[model samples]
Target chain A: MKSETVSTLLVEAASLLAIGMVFVFLFLALLIAAINLIAAFCRKFPGNFPAESSSVPLTKPLATPSRKIDDTTLAVIGAAVHQYRKQHQSNVKD
Target chain B: MDKFDVLWQSTALAHFTLGQMAMMLVGLLLLYLAIVKKFEPLLLLPIGFGALLTNIPLAGFSQAGGILFYIYEVGIDTGVFPLLIFMGVGAMTDFGALIANPRMLLLGAAAQFGIFATLFGAIALNWVPGFSFSLQDASAIAIIGGADGPTAIFLASKLAPELLGAIAVAAYSYMALVPIIQPPIMKALTTPEERKIEMEQLREVSQREKIIFPIAVLLLTILFLPAATPLVGMFCLGNLMRECGVVERLNKTAQNELINIVTIFLGLAVGSKLSADKFLTVETLGILALGAIAFGIGTATGVLMAKLMSRVSSRKINPLIGAAGVSAVPMAARVVNKVGLEANPHNFLLMHAMGPNVAGVLGSAVAAGVLLALVG
Candidate 1:
């Protein structure tokens, strides 16, 4: 009706929007902080999930076992070791 | 002169002259970039073809109720095309990395500073001859900084439909060139040591968090930015289809068929706007220059924010990854990884950089909302 009344309504609407925005910002800031907190926890202790736990035991099997050597192969290894030890002993004595 | 005039008059059925033929060759070059170079082939191919059609003088492709014209009306003019494309992007995007590293949100938000900065650059460009851009038009054109095609198309649809072709072209072109444009700035900003900073392995984001994120973001949009919800809502819808794990059919269709189909229509619609009278102008050059400035500013802001957080966190964050904050998705992330490898062959920042890359997508959509609110 009157210009003053319309202006008053407009002012009220603006204020409402501002207040609404502030609240939205605060809520989002908190939610983001919460997500960051959870992600930080997850990073520190990852295998709490079953999937992450499954990936860990995979690399453990790579440690090869000690095996008995063939006679010829063992003789070659022993001769090479003997030569290496003799050189080390000479160097140490010097 | 008389002989030449007689010969020219004798040349009937000659629809295209030499200059028009050259422009057509330029269109062919763009097509090569699309098909062979794979520079966003889905859009670029259609756009290059449309450019050729529009420049053909008497081609009825741009006339009333023509295919391109109808597509423009149904999609681009109504702003539905970009929104639908956002759905595909959301379905394809992985927010897991950003969720794993929440602090990357800061980088994502910081990257938007360039968007606003270029708005000013666009307005100031009006001081030059043959370039006249209003504030709203400048705001619309400057969104190419996001490097997101749909967002560029979205804003242009609202503020400057006449400028859509240029904005979309700049956005997609720079996107394809992110590998070229970003590395120098990233290298200049950080030392070899900073680039070599090995990021800790990203923690796995849970299925629950992954599923909830899109919903949360959609709710946030509903509350904070209703103007952006049309684009963001469809985006979340597509992401929900993906993350829910039950809608494999919808996810497949949205990501593959629906998106590809819409991209052709959208590109053709946008390309149809590239008539010589509308496109070959000083204003288009201004838009291109402003887009570059927008992209540069967005990149610089991301790096600066990353640097700031590094001090605050007491652990090093690779500032190079921050350059991915311009919404180029995997391309920006790949660029970060590539540049990081140049510094230290050991470092792999692709997955880590993806956090800001995707988050920047959301940030730019939010920026688009702000523009719609302020301008619409």
Candidate 2:
């Protein structure tokens, strides 16, 4: 009796394995076709949806230069560069 | 003197049993693995803590009217937490790789053979004395082979609520050990040359295709296998929220805050089932053993299937990515990539592996549905 019950249970489990694996394969196989169809549709009609570029920019444009540098500021900037280069040259020589 | 005696009797120390003490130690071991070893800390930590709470003598944490009891009833018994977790997983998933190469779905389906094969293993155990598993119990145990924690918990809660704790622990612990468990099977099945083969790059998938992919998956699932709709439906909703790009806030919440909250409750609820009466049994040992065998079989089948595909296809396909079909998410995929890299340093298989990795998620969910439909 015990052996009979075990055999029946094993048979049921085997059937389930067959059915489950086949159904999983079939469902996913159909999904593969659906995905391919969707891809083909999107390719045939690219303009149906708005492009991502049309959205508002996510970041603020780095603060634009509104005013030109004055002669005094440029001279100061030039002097700073000269000083830094002189110090670097001295350090390298050392 | 009577007051003193009554007070002493009420203390936990007075009521402690050997079983409770052993279960508490098991809880501490889980905590050690989660904290010290860093094995799936997100779920294991809370699960461990809940185990501690539930096993306290006379605490009644898993009994009627306790917080743990109510949480388990509301979350696990109702089967809400796992579905919610699946939704969050869907929200976080990117099907770009899957879409670029749809053939990988076969690899995903092939991996579920582990789940079904383990069903036979579970039932065969009944021949042993002290081991008698009904069809439902066997089904619940077999899903641990899917290597999906949420799906395992979902099926176990529905089919065999008594085995939920063991199933969940086995599923998650084995998932955490994917790196260790999968490599040997993968290496043994494939040639070193096959591991080194690199495939063509995946094409960029347009956002439009991404938007439709989830809907398509849901449609196919509902039309053919309605039993799987609950898991697949919530998963699609989460994926759609992610891909539609209009629901950024909802998508973010679903993947992040919502998932984290549900995970905590889900872990604790699963832990509540770890009470000594439920956990310290001969069946628990059987479950743990069968769980490992399931994982080994799943990984082996996945690699063998990949080898077969490689032999037939004109394109050179590496067999390592097949192991990713077991669906430990990016972890399985990463292991594949690592193995491939070890064989050939320049050969990167991460993106390729992701194709089948995500498919394995669907595969397991489908397998779960099948088990639910057949056994439940």
Candidate 3:
């Protein structure tokens, strides 16, 4: 009875292995297909999706100025430049 | 004199057996390995300590009425602990890389060849004298090849609880040894040129894709292999908690406190099974040997699969990432990264290897489900 059981188990194991390999392959193939389909749909309907704000733009395009900088904006820019020079000079000294 | 005799009788010295003494030493060795070598210290340390506690005479810690027994019966026997651990693993896992390039799932699936192949190897061991393994036993033993600790423990608990101690030890030990074991096979199979091939950067996977991924996978698994639902279902629950923004508290608890608490109990329960009669046998040796062969085979097949895929695919794929298909998670991926860097100084394969690494986890769970459906 024991030997018969072992023989049966051995046969079962071989079959299970073959079945397992095929099952894994088929399941993963389906997953791959699903992912591709989703990706294609996303690409085709890009406007419906949110833009990626987290990524920094590699190069900013220069757009024509809509309006001239006012005196207040110039004053703020001057103050910012002064602060940057002050920090840069201090770091240079250090 | 009666009082003295009573006190003496209560001492472990009065009841110590050679088996208990030997098991105690084994426990100490595990402790040393965990603490000094830092080989899976979090789990191993508790396991080692539990071993020490169980082996002490007069404690009866592993007996039916004992605390360890209750923990084992409630958790390990019913297969709750490993499922809880899976939930935590899922919560911690990030599937962004896997979603970006779904082809990595092939490597994951291929790595499971180790598990199924080891089934035959376990049964083949019956040809040796004084060795006999039933089909259920072989199924439990073969899962060590999956290189997944919780899945191995869960499957072993269900199929062959008697072998749980040896199989768990083998599974975790092999996982820890991924750094040592994977590199040589990775190097032997690939040329320097193949090893140095730089993969293109993975595209950014959207938050929406990430959110839908666990649900989609869970639904697919339930439809095709409902047997896998226990492990995969809990895993998807954890992943959903992580991906969905609303359950931050639940996610943190699953990943941190809940898993930690269950890990302690799980380790103790596994260690309780390390008594000499169970652990010190010819079968233990067979299991260890089969586990090594299984892990080795899995690693080789994963690399081979990648090599085959690289030829068919349009883009270049560094075959080292295929070694991560063994499901040792970040460790296997890290090994691939380290190996890739050695071959080319500028190469970074960490993000790319993660694709196959996470896929290996899901693949192993599916394989476990298959085994359970067949043999359980």
Indicate the DockQ of the complex predicted as candidate 2: 0.47
Question: Model 2: iRMSD?
Answer: 2.5
How many clashes (backbone atoms < 3 Å, residues ≥3 apart in a chain or on different chains) does model 3 have? 0
**Best by TM-score, which number?**
2
Docking level for model 2: acceptable
The order by descending lDDT is 2, 3, 1
Model 3 agreement with the true structure over A1-94: per-residue lDDT tens digits = 2666667778888998999888887887788887777777666765534334324333455884757899999999999999999999999999
Off by over 4 Å in 2: A48-50, A53-94
Tens-place lDDT digits, model 1, residues B1-376: 9998877766533556655565567678779999999998878899989878766755667788567778889998888888889999889987888888877876777787777777766766655566667656877887898788999899998999888888888899889988888888888888888898988998767866676788878887888789889988999998988787766677878999999999989888887887766677788888888888888988988888788777788667989878988888889899999999988999999998998898788778877887777766
Provide the TM-score of chain A alone for each candidate, in the order shown: 0.46, 0.53, 0.51
Candidate 2 residue lDDT tens string, B1-376: 9999999999999999999999999899999999999999999999999999999988899889899999999999999999999999999999999999998998999999999999999999999989989999999999998888999999999999999999999999999999999998899998888888999999989889998999999888888889999999999999998888777778889999999999999999998898888899999999999999999998998898889999999877898999999999989999999999999999999999999899999999999999988889
Give the C-alpha miss distance for residue A5 in model 3, angstroms: 4.7
Candidate scoring better on lDDT of 1 and 2: 2
| Model 3 chain B weakest 10-residue run by lDDT | B241-250
How accurate locally is residue B319 in candidate 1, as Cα lDDT from 0 to 100? Answer: 90
For each candidate in turn, the TM-score is: 0.79, 0.92, 0.89
